[model samples]
Target: MLKEALAFKRPLIFADSFFVNKPERVEMILFLMSLCLLVYNLDQRELRNSLKRAKTGVKSQICKLTDYHTLRFI
Candidate 1:
């Protein structure tokens, strides 16, 4: 993902260097901003999934511990 983002950005940076006009620069800036936002959203989604998996693992462990304790009492 990082590599892809860098690939997308490199051409735009090169283009910006050649184009000095206001409108084109504005368009390029907007494109870069949107690209950054997209990358950020993808990162956030990955983080959320990881946290969810961790939560599920912890819950299962707790359930197993509780079941073991209950069985011991019986």
Candidate 2:
């Protein structure tokens, strides 16, 4: 899961989209990314909980119904 989450943030390794030479800058960027990932996971959990409480589900990528939708999908 950790690997997938990190890969999701930066899809392409050779993209060179973000370049930080300084250690402080790299640390800051990592901190921000971690915070954002935390928020994303929390939001997904809340959505899943709410759907379960409501006894409803959204269609998944396979076109099947699922209340425990993944954070990466939906």
Candidate-wise lDDT, in order: 0.52, 0.80
Name the weakest run of 10 consecutive residues (lDDT summed) in model 2: 7-16
- CA RMSD of all predictions: 15.1, 2.7
Residue 31 lDDT, candidate 2, scale 0-100: 92
Model 2 lDDT per residue over 1-74, tens place: 66766675455444367788899998898798789889988898899999999999999878888899766676
lDDT of 1 at 43: 66
* lDDT value, residue 33 of candidate 2: 71
Candidate 1 global TM-score: 0.46
Off by over 4 Å in 2: 1-3, 8-15
Q: Find the 10 residues in a row with the least total lDDT in model 1.
A: 65-74
Q: What TM-score, to 2 decimals, does candidate 2 have?
A: 0.75
Candidate 1 error regions (>4 Å): 1-21, 56-74
lDDT of 1 by residue, 26-49 (tens): 888879778866876576556556
* lDDT assessment of candidate 1: 0.52
